[model samples]
Target: MRAGGFLIPVLLVLAGCKPEPEAPALALHPVPVQQRLPAQVSAPALESGRVSIRGDDALADVLSWTLPEASIEQPARARAAARRALAKGDLFETAESAIPLLLALRKAQPDNAQDARLLEKARAALLAQAWIALDAGEDLASLRYAQRHGTVLRTLWPALPEAKTYLDAVDRAGQAFELCVGGERALHAGNLDTSGGALELFRRAQALWPLQTRAQRGIAAVQAALLAGAQAQAAEGDFEGAYAELSRAGRVRSDAEAIATARQRIEATRTDRIRRLGDEGLMALADPAGLQIARERLAEILRIALPGSGAGVALRQRIDLVGHYGLFRPGQVFTDEMADGGRGPALSVLPRGGFSMGAPEDEEGASPDEQPQHPVRFERGFAMTRHEITVGQFRRFVTATGATPRATQRGHSLAYDARSGNFLRGSGIDWQSGYDGRPAGEDMPVIHVTARDAEAYAAWLSEQTGVHYRLPSEAEFEYALRAGGQTLYPWGVGAPPAGAGNLAGGKDVSTRGRSWSNAFPGYGDGWWGPAPVGRFAANAYGLYDMVGNVSEWVADCWHRGYRRAPSNGQAWVNPGCRTRMYRGSSWASAPAQARSAWRASGGVDATNARVGFRLVRQL
Candidate 1:
């Protein structure tokens, strides 16, 4: 009888409850056609029976809603009978009930005071009945019962404040009904946990009318479906999918014991599957050639197992330790035994650590290509040759494989022309040539070798030493060049410490008495060309000649910048690339080129004196 317990005189208008004006003369003017508009709040889904005033229950019937034919056409007689019916507690339930009968009488004689009084009495009875239904329970059926009475009052007499209140309540019931029905349809369509699925629909319905039986059942049914789906998913060894389904179920009822029970079941199944996968991975790891298969198994276990699970973590560690060719420690100096009863190049096990790989924008000599610095980490210890590979190492590849390098096959290579202060193609120059186109010492870093030549030497060394060997990735080169130094320069933010390595210097003059126009001030290595390998001091990582050496080809394609660069120290390469990256500064490189992040590229088939490469072995 009130809007949220406060009398609201104008609430009916807000609810769209404007009734027709009462007639002043005692004559039955038929109800207007517009006033007989069909009711929007149909009660077809309610249990109170066919409840439209349109007088037809056919599915497609669209006739206007109206009161029953005026029974007892005599106004005075109808008024007395309605009073008797009201005293007997007969209300809107029956055609002859006091509310409907009196409404018809008032229509025939709109100014009859006695009939109007009697109708108000019947409305009071109707309100009492609706209150009883409202207080009956929060179940869907009881709510619908109350809505049925509200519908009757709103249609025939909507001026009362109570009609607006009950009208709003009935509208909510209609919404709840629609939502529950949609939930049922989604359940049948197998849309369990997706957006707008059964779970979402049912939970929304419950919110509108808490514990309304139909909505409650819809929620329970969705939860059950989710739990069953989780079990089936786990049975198929898809533990992640199972956990996903269980999580969906928990959203429906977080404290439901069934969720915890299903989670436990899924966990047991997942643990067993992870153990079985670990065993298979271990078996694969036992084979000398099964590392790839073991890696695949490790990937699967990580997907299903919780983070840091013992089985998953242990298997990963074992896989990483498989190819420990030297069993060396970080910063440990060691060499693998070669098949020829010799030894591989001296190597320093670079420590496993992280470093900012590219130059910061604030660094004076930093270029746009080095903007957006990114971090790189080495997860496993790797062995990098302490210095560039020498002419002697490459000579062994040429003789054993009969592989003629590009420079040799072409009968010439790029060599520094001292007289012109430029590099020009030279005759009869090859990997065995020096920076001056003369026969090079075996200890000098090999010159006039293409990237393919470097890679070929690595392959030959791998066969000889029975260990993996390849050109270091650009990230690895930069990491070693930095050598735990985050300064702008490899040797710190000043001139390269004297005799640091072979670098273009202000104090050094060429054989023709030419000095570097853009060289480090107050510094010179006293060499007009690349010095013999490791001629200078080792970096903090205990590797020699990293900051200043012949610029070396690394195993990466020439990408424009650090965008989408690899975070780990792996090579970011593109297959069949024509331009490959070279890192570290050469003896001819300027001070700007000596920054740890500086890099350059040459054609894959390009061979020159200023560029050489070193080998890195897997540990």
Candidate 2:
């Protein structure tokens, strides 16, 4: 007989043979030992019938896995007979031959209960083996073994703590086995979804056994094949394919390091390929001297416009903007301002290098109108209004230049209400409402202003201060918001764990509620009125109220879509019409409406309690 005749016959029998009639199952009874030892002793009775060398060879293969360096004695003649029986597919004879040794196990135990308990454990192990085999797609063999083992476990279930575990494992294995067979049929008949579902079950089964070398390798191989297909698609210029492949890889393996590596490689490959295809190109510096001059001018503007601001906060904002938009390097700043209802002598200055820009797509109230998103790119930088033009500040300008006030109230700011002629709160006034919504106050933001009024203020300030101040282009507003990173919010995505912003008033107004309406705590959702500006944590850029206080008016006029939008960081003002852009959001809006990318618009004259403005300058 060949060296592996015993194993070869067993394997061939298992491959095609049907199960035999069930016999009374034998139990495993452990030997009683006076002292603990590293290894277990075989039962003497079974040892006598073990066919010595043939049995030893068979047991050796199984034991080697658990104890790599082991030696055993074998009787050549007895081994030869055992090997011949195995070669002839005589499993019954082989199994019967081992029973003598098994009986000795029963004798070794002191009591019938102990013998019974050990036998139950042995039965459970067989059940577990059935389960493992089923998962490996060995349906017939696993089912036969499971039926045999399960019968023994059911009889002994009351005596074993592990009986339930073995039962459950067997059930899971049965389910997986069914799926695998069904999946093979589905694949043959071209039912991709059904086939895929079964494959997924197989993958899941493999994952459950972290230490199963065969299962682990099988999973990895399947995943690698899928990724390879995706890579091919990506190579053919299918960006969607590439993304899908990477996403699949992520599902297969959630290792952070692996995911990151794949991400980097994917990006590098795509970028290189895109460049080769000439789909995009880099901008070369046009004039070094002009760029330097712009830089210096921007620095000077920042020195004046952002004086006394915390360095940490401002620097952080700048870094965020640069990273998100890839618009400018860290520390760039640019300013634009609006004034006097579009009555300008507008001053434009370069905001110094490094400013945050752009909002993410998912912010509250963000709409499709805000997409086709990219970074803000300002060729030059300058100074911007530290605060929205205040009633007092505008009043000072009026006083300095002798410009007539729209409303001639001594202390009462002239605001028009639809019902009342002059309202104190600017309740119903358009953006052009005079007196800056307060009586000569230099610190209060100029309210009730239209886009035109904002532009007028910018022009007036430029003429008086010799510094060009203008409304920040839409791009500039985003840049300022980002400040220093690619965060979802000016602060960061998700609600800050600490209560910070003034929305419906909670850690996260959008996410805090039990339901949509219940999301915010302490405050009703957009049902309550608006609050004053600077009412929440300032973003890293030193800008306050970028979200949920009041929506700030932006330089861009309304366009339903981003088609033909400018890429130079300037406001897209061509064929511009009645509607104007607003960013951030207000108390009256839902949390979704307060996202960084959120946008709103109304007629040029439209004004609301939650509408406000900030100014920027370029030098």
Q: After superposition, how far is residue 4 of candidate 2 from its true place, in Å?
A: 98
lDDT of 1 by residue, 226-316 (tens): 7777777886778777888888778876557888788898888887677556544644553455678779888888887787666576568
Error of 2 at 62 (Å): 99
Candidate 1 TM-score, true structure as reference: 0.50
Predicted model with the maximum lDDT: 1
- The lDDT values for all models are 0.73, 0.45
Per-candidate total of colliding backbone pairs: 0, 84
Which runs of model 2 end up more than 4 angstroms from their true locations? Answer: 1-366, 400-442, 496-499, 506-519, 522-536
Quote each prediction's TM-score. 0.50, 0.37
Model 2 C-alpha lDDT per residue in residues 197-252, reported as the tens digit of each score: 42464454343322223334333433444444455555555656666766765676
